[model samples]
Target: MDQFDWKQLLNPEFYILLELGGIKIGLYVVLFIVFAETGLLAGFFLPGDSLLFLCGIYSEALMKEFSTGSDFLNVTFLAASISVMGILGNMLGYWFGSKSGTYLYKREDSFFFKKKYLFQSKDFFEKYGGKAVVFARFLPIFRTFAPVIAGIVAMDKKKFMFYNILGSILWSYVMIFAGHYLHKLFLSQFNIDLTHYIEFIVIGIVLVTTIPVLMKLLKKKA
Candidate 1:
């Protein structure tokens, strides 16, 4: 048996603080997560919608300034911007996977990167078609690597890019806006900074949103 350090596991509260910090830092983390998750296997677990939603919810609380989305870097615009980041990340992932999968893997491994989960993601991409690009954006444990795998398998580049852009924007914006509007609808009671809850809650929703897959994983592990 191996001893797993629990502290190594992501602390949900860290994400909460990131959310409560406001737009600039919040958006920075969101963009980083989106880019890294799709850009490289090593970053698959980085926070996404949970943080983004929190950003939307708590945009007023942060201590920085920026201008982008609706009425001053609103969630809509934040989502849209990060969506582009995700797409670009996927593009880089694809190129890396297609042209230098092994070399890239080896290089990353030299730095202690683990990609055990990405194998499953690759299989999912194989089983599904280009739809994986769009739909995978909403699936945990699969969304991060599906596009990269598409490149490994030599999926059509132009077509993959189209789906990639559409899905990245749709997924990123959907989660951020959902948090924004949902909180706006109930600010009196449920009001909290969206980012504070999003990096974890939104991710939980995305994961739970595809419960069947999770159940299968649980069953397999069992």
Candidate 2:
């Protein structure tokens, strides 16, 4: 791999992975991004799914940054850590929505805020009700706003938390483990290194996750 390029900092893939400025805090950065992406409205553009997948690919290395655990333990720790961040993020988002009420709807759109995304989340929440908390976990923008929407409508707290915990674990573990095991499988069986193809992998994950969101938005427009 080439030396970490400053220019790559502008790229979401590198940014989310904390490959900038020779920073070794990949784990902390990943956790914070997970939290922001799930909890903060401005974090809608952050690369949540791709970040999780990349973390999987780099699981062992990331673990070594903090521990000498076995491979399985490393991946589990990474996934569990990320899951906790995601859960907390959703809780914060819910709290924000519950306290803010209709303020978000009336708030003007800035560079980081888009009213359409909020409305889309609203539609998704209305259509799926409580299930949106779970379903939105896989979708990009929806995942960021679903909890907030639930909070806005004052959805039952216990029910919201049940779905929140369920969704966070499912989403985090699936993405992270898929990356970890797939990377191991390909390297061991096919002699292929996924790190070299990280860009393509990131792009593929983004498209797969975002296409549904785009289609939903388009369908609504039509």
Question: Residue 191 deviation, candidate 1, in Å?
Answer: 6.9
Cα lDDT for residue 168, candidate 1: 89
Cα lDDT tens digits, model 1, 1-222, are 446556533543344345333333544655666788778654545555455556556554432355443444555566677788888888988887788766544543333255655676766676678988888887765777787778778988899999999998888777767666777776667766444453467557656656856775687689
Model 2 TM-score is 0.92
- TM-score of every candidate relative to the true structure: 0.74, 0.92
Runs in model 1 with CA error above 4 Å? Answer: 1-24, 61-64, 68-73, 102-115, 188-210, 218-222
- 92-206 in candidate 2: lDDT tens per residue? 9999999995999999988778888899899999999999998998998898899899999999999999999999999989999999999999999999999999889878998
* lDDT (Cα, 0-100) at 56 in candidate 1: 57
How much is the lDDT of residue 123 in candidate 2? Answer: 91
Quote the RMSD, in angstroms, for model 2. Answer: 2.5
- In order, the Cα lDDT scores of the candidates are 0.66, 0.85
